[model samples]
Target: MAIGWLSILKAVPWTDVVSNAPKVADGAKKLWETVARKKAPTGTSASATSDTSSPAGQEARIAELAGELDRLQQEMLASSQLLKTLAEQNAQLVRRVYWQSRLLLVVGLIAVAGLTLVLLR
Candidate 1:
C-alpha cells in the first residue's frame, strides 16, 4: 500500500495546540500520518498492551484511522474554501472603497475651485 501525505496529517496527535485529542488539519497530512503509523511501530507502543490484538484487530484500527483522516480532510477543505472566498470579497471591498475615496477627493477639489473663482469675480 502507498502511504500519502494525507495519511501523515491524520495520524498526528492534534492536542499539542488545539484539543485534548489529536485532530488532523489536512487530508494530505493525514494520509502521510496513516502511512507512518503503520510502517513505524515506534508510535502507539504504549497502546499495544493488554494482549487482545491480533492481525485483524490491527487492521480494524487502521480502518478506523483511515475514516478519521477522511473526516479531518473534509473539514480542512471546507474551512480553506471559506477563507479563500472571504479574502476575495475583502479585496473587492477595498478596491471599491479606494475608488470612492478618489472620486470624493476630485469632487471636493472641483467645488473648492468654483468657490474661489466666484470670490475673484
Candidate 2:
C-alpha cells in the first residue's frame, strides 16, 4: 500500500509530467533492475544500522543534499538564460541609441559645414 502511494505521489503531474509518464516508468524500471542486479548491501556495513548518528542517516542526508543540488542547478540554469536574454535586450537598446546619436551628429556636422561654405561664398 505504501509502495502504491509512493508511485502516485511521485507522479505528481507537475508541468510536463503528463507527457513524461512513459519515460518516468522506464526510468523507475531501470532503477529497480540496477538495484536488484547489484549485490545487496552487506549488513556488516556501518550504514546498515538505523540508529541515531548512524551511517545510514548520513547517507540519506547526502542523498537529500544531492537532490537539492540538482534542483538548484536547474534553477541556476534558468536564471542564467533569463539574464542572458536581458543582457541581449540591453545591448540592442544601447546599439539603437548609439546609431541614433551618430545619425544626429552626422546631420548636425553636415548642416554646419554647408552653412559655413555658403557664408564663405
Clashes per candidate, residues 3 or more apart or on different chains? 22, 0
Best by lDDT: 2
Best by TM-score: 1
Candidate 2: clashing pairs of residues: none
Q: Residue 88, candidate 2: how far off, in angstroms?
A: 1.3
Listed in order, each prediction's TM-score against the native is: 0.57, 0.48
- Model 2 per-residue lDDT tens digits across residues 48-89: 344427777778767866876776665566556555655655
Q: Write the per-residue lDDT of candidate 1 for residues 59-116, one digit (tens) a residue.
A: 8778867877786676667657556655655565566556656776898999999999
| Model 1 / residue 27 / CA error / Å | 19
Worst 10 residues of 2 by lDDT: 11-20
Off by over 4 Å in 2: 1-52, 114-121
